[model samples]
Target chain A: MAHIELKNIRKSFGLVDVIKGVDLEIFSGEFMVFVGPSGCGKSTLLRLMAGLEDITSGEMSFDGTLVNALAPSRRGIAMVFQSYALYPHMTVYENMAFGMQLAKSSKEAIQERVEKAAELLQITPYLSRLPKQLSGGQRQRVAIGRAIVRDPKVFLFDEPLSNLDAALRVATRLEIAKLHHAMNSATMVYVTHDQVEAMTLADRICVLRDGLVEQVGTPLELYENPQSLFVAGFIGSPKMNFLNGEIASKFGANTIGIRSEHIEIADRDGSWKGKVVHSESLGSDSFVYVDIGMSGDPVIVRQEGTRHHNPDDAISIAPIPGKIYRFDAAGKPLKH
Target chain B: MTLDLWTITKRTAFYALVVFIVFVAVFPFYYAILTSFKSGTDLFRVTYWPVSFSWDNYISVLSTGSFPRNLLNSVFVASVTVLAALFLAITASFALSRVRFRGRSLLLMTILAVSMFPQIAVLAGLFEVIRFLGIYNTPWALIFSYTIFTLPFTVWVLTTFMRDLPIEIEEAAIVDGATPWIIIWRVFLPLLWPALVTTGLLAFIAAWNEFLFALTFTSSNATRTVPVAIALLSGGSQYEIPWGNIMAASVIVTVPLVVLVLIFQRKIISGLTAGGVKG
Candidate 1:
């Protein structure tokens, strides 16, 4: 296991800067997810850690040893790519055994490690098949199995589940969670744009924006106490609805953010008046979109269980006491 | 279903065009085979089909004189040239296609430009180089010259194919502790098989049929390749040419190429189109 540290790291492509400056430390045996929107350089940061891309400046150390010039193989890291880059010509067994074969392990050792990894991933049945012969999910499992056979000190996944279909994505996500538990000593860095993945899988989430570290915290730390308006809006589903103008002024703030689940449809004495626009029922919960007329966009109110409110139904909405997040004009959160 | 008049006419025209094309392509080779089987006066007749069958001409081409030696020279030169060209081209392709460097596209263009020069334009200079290398009258001279011409084409084609290979695959190999050589040999070579077969076969045919360098570089009767040997086949007198022996030699030389194409036809087709588009 290795503890990774980045000190004033920067990356640029030609004259265009991607990662300006970032400093963070990943503890040994931690699952760190870099979550951000597209073009946010999250993947690039993971690539830098994997030694696939050279750091433009600053230092990166794994286990307190500087690895700026180390080759990817010597970095003691294994990476699972977004595209599941399995060697198409190699059988699943060969693909898993390849790293060991290159390391010139004993033939029996290679076979044993490959089979053990294959059984762990439940891919033993497909071990003789080529990558093309397997489905997208199976191919991805083979990719992970290959990494397991490497038994690296660190694991880097560059959106490894992004290519799978939605149903398979969930199944594979579960498999990865189980893998992290089983390989608890190995430090892993996962990159994804999906906040759901960040919230569910990461022991600590590193939010990146415009090539800079926005915040680093556990999922609950980010959700419950976001340091900035960006983190407040990004860390939650249905997005935190913001009220501006007179409504925000009454709350003694320039903007006030309240998550969908924090708002309730109050029959009277409601904080804001609006007309119901539409609602989506997901059986377990439903979200009703309300147009409060003050905010340009409709406010989404998440309600428990199946709930129905017809379009144009006049309603009053209120955020639960002390639930609103106040932000100043510059987007920094104001003291409660 | 019954065929209408227009359908019949369209079908007839299509078959007619097909027959015409096949006739045009195969006529000369068919005539050579026919003549190879004919003896004496029958060789003079312009026959559409076989007039007689005999192995006398083949027996003469194989059993007599320096033809067999020349055949061996052709085989040696062409095989070596293909092997050398493919081996060098594959390695060059990795650098040209995958490795990032300054002046990469320019270097690629320069390589392509080298192939654009007419072989005759470089013939005299090549002769000096061959002589300087002290391989002027040996199979090495032909192999050396053929590789020079074929390298550009093989490198260009294999580079394009290698470029189409996903960069992620190479990166994955690197993370798996594969050196550049292992990546090329284990990961890339399998994916590049079709392109190799296509280029190797083409290079083989080019070297096998090449006559000018084979004639000029080798002065010894024993050292000349089949093409030159076939051209120099003589008759009983200075005024006569042994057309039967020439046709038989042509048949012998051309058969191997035909067989090679047939065996690798599927690979060649896939190779021609493989890197042209993303899969």
Candidate 2:
């Protein structure tokens, strides 16, 4: 494990700047996740840390030692790409053992490490098989296995689960969570646009917007108290609803952010009232979209269980106590 | 059911077209095989089918002055040319395709432009360079020239194929502690076998069939390649050309290429069209 710090790091491709200036410190053995919408420079930031992309200007140090000029391998970082990126011609064993073999490790050591990684990933049975023979999920495991055998100080995942089916994504996500617990000492920085993955997997989530750090906190901290309107919306699934104009002005704010689950279906005295426009019953929860006549568009209110409301049915909704978030004119959160 | 007259006519015409095309393409090689096995007056006759069978022409061509030596010279030159071109192209294409840099497209376009120049336009200039290098009349002359000539096509094709390789694979290799050279040899090279095979075979065929430079560069039979030797195969006098011996030599030279292409026919076809469509 290493302490990674980026001081005012900036990355640009000629004219268009991707990562403007980001300063972040990742603690030893920290599971730091970078999450944002597409093109927010989250992947670029990850690449900068992995030494894949050169930082335009800044100090990047691992464990108090500057690693700006170090090659990727020398930096002791292993990255799992969105695409598995396994050597297509090589068998799973060779793919996993390639890095060690390049370092000229002994044959026995190489095999031992490879088999260990394979066992950890439950891919020992497929070690002798070429990448083409494996399915998408298996191939990703092999890719991760390849990374594991390296035993790097830092483990970087660039959306490793993005390329799988829904069922496989869930299965692999669980496996990754277990993997983090299994390798607690290795600092991991994962980059993904999926906030659910960010919420579930991250110890501390860094929300990026336009190459800048919008906010960095634990998943719940971001959910409960977002510093910016972007984070308030980006950190939650079904998205945090924003009400503006008269409804927000009533609270002396430009916009008010409320998470779907945080809003309740009121019995009689409710802050907002509207007819149910659309609803999705996902067994455990029902996401009912209400056409509340607020300045904002239809509000998505999460209700427990299935099929609680239908279209043309009237309902009153209100946020739970002081759970609603207020934001001013500049999208900066306004604390009451 | 009885076949319709129109269907029968269309089928007959299609078969006739196919026969014509095959005959047009294969008649010369077929005739060479036939002529290679004939002796004496039969060489004069216009025989489509084998009227006589004799190994006399083959024996003469093989045993006669320096044909075997010329064959060896051709082999050495072509193999060297193909190997040199492919080795250089593999590394160059890796950089040109995989590594982004300033003026990459400009550089690639310049290479494409250089290859488009007519070979005859540079024949004199190339001859001078060959002589200046002191490789003229040696197999080195042909090898050097052919490698330079083949580099553009090989580089272009290989670069296209190399570009198609997923970038993440290269990044993964980088994280795995592979230098560019290691990645090329171990990672990109293996995935690129089919493309290499295709380009390598094409380069071999080009080097093997090359004649203008070969004839101009070498004066002695020992240094001359098979194509030049075959062209210069003559009888006692100027008027009398050894057609049978030429055909026999042609047959011998062509068999190896035919076998090579046949063996790697799949790879070459795929290689030639590899970058045209997404894999």
Candidate 3:
């Protein structure tokens, strides 16, 4: 395993800069995820680290050895692409054995390694089939198997689950979580625009925005104490609701942010009142959209299982005490 | 009754058009085959169908001075040209399509421009190069010149085809420690079977049919390629043409191409049309 460090890493394509200055360190055996919206340079940063793209200007070192000029193969890193990127003509066994064959490993050794990796991914049955014959999730597992047989010092995944259907994405995500635990010694860097993937799989989530690192912390750390408004908004699903004008002024801030799950429905006397505009029930949790007459869209509050709130019903909501996130004029978090 | 008549007329028209297109495309080759089987004045008679099956013309053409040798020459030239052109084109295309460098578009445009040049326009220049290389009068001359000319078309087609391959596959190969050559050989070349087959067949046909370079570069009857040898076929009188023998040679030369296309029609058609539309 290798500890990777990037200092002031920057990548530019022609006149346009994709990854501006970024500094981050990933420890050996850490599952680090670069999560951001599209065009936020998370993938680009991962590419830079994988040696797929050259760094424009930066210090990149792995295990204290500078590798800014190293080839991807030389970097001892294996990447799983979003498209699975399996050789369409190669059977699953050959696909997994390709890297080793290129490396001139013994045929017996290659067979052993390939079969082991295929077994680990539970794709042994399809080893004789070409990539075209396998389903999307199966193709992705073969890709991971291909990467695994490399016994790479660092593993890089570039949005590997985005191509699968929603159900398959979840199933594969769990598979990856198990994989990370199983291969505990290898450092892994994953990139995705999906916050749920980042939240669930990451040992530390690095939030990126427009070529800059917005925040880097554990998933809960980013959820609970996002350093800036961008992270506060980007790190959560259905978004962390914001009340900016009078409501925020009342709280002595420029904007007061609250996640829907952290907000409670008050029975009689609550901090804010609104009419229910919409609600979505997903068995485990229901999202209740309230027209609180706030600055932007209607505030959404999470109600646990089987909670029924009809549209047009008047409801009062309050943010859980001390759970409210306050930000100042610059979007930097304000001290509570 | 009127609606049924209208439908019948439209159906008749569609079938007629299809028959016309197929006949127009195939009639010449059919006539050549018909002529090849006939002897003497029967070649002159305009016949839509074969009147007789005589092996005399085939015998005469194969036994005639240097005709079979020329056939061998054409085969050698075409095969060598295809191999050389495909080798150069595949590597050139990988650079043109995948590698990002300054003047890449300019380089690709230059390749396309080279192929656009008429073969006759460069006849003298290529002749000189062939002579200077000391390969003139040898199959090497035709092979060398044909490879150069075929490269432009092959490279342009392969580049376009190669450009359509998923970039992620290349990156995956790279992560697998594939050198660009390995990526082309092991990863890319197999996926590119369609493009290769299409381009190689076209290149083979072009070289097999080439006359201008083959004639200019070779002075001996033995070294001349099939097209040139077929052109030089004559009768007892200057006014008389050995149409029967010529037809037999033509049929022989064309059989391989027709057979190749028949076998690979699906892949060739798909290769030609691939990346021309979005799925």
Model 1 C-alpha lDDT per residue in residues A1-336, reported as the tens digit of each score: 999999999999999899999999999999999999999999999999998899999999999999999999999999998888888878888988999999999999999998999999999999998787788888888899999999999999999988888999999999999999999999999999999999999999999999999999999999999988899989989788988898899889999999999888886564688898998999999999999896478999999999999999998888898998999999999998
User: After superposition, which runs of candidate 2 have C-alpha atoms over 4 Å from their true positions?
Assistant: B1-9, B266-279
lDDT of 2 by residue, A175-260 (tens): 99999999999999999999999999999999999999999999999988899988888878898899998888988899988889
Residue pairs that clash (backbone atoms under 3 angstroms), model 3 = none
- Assess every candidate by TM-score: 0.97, 0.96, 0.95
TM-score of candidate 1 relative to the true fold: 0.97
lDDT by residue (tens digit), candidate 3, A193-257: 99999999999999999999999999999998999999999888889998899889988999999
Tens digits of per-residue lDDT, candidate 3, B1-279, equal 999999999999999999999999999999899989999778778898767899998999898789989988888989989999999999999999998899999988887898888888999888888889999899999999899889988999899889988898889899999999998998788778889998999999899988888889999998999999999998779999889889999999999888988898777545332221111
Error of 1 at B235 (Å): 1.0
C-alpha DockQ of every model: 0.47, 0.49, 0.48
Candidate 2 docks at the CAPRI level of: acceptable
In model 1, pairs of residues that clash are none
Per-residue accuracy of model 2 over B167-220 as CA lDDT, tens digit each:
888898899899999989988887788888989999999999999999998999
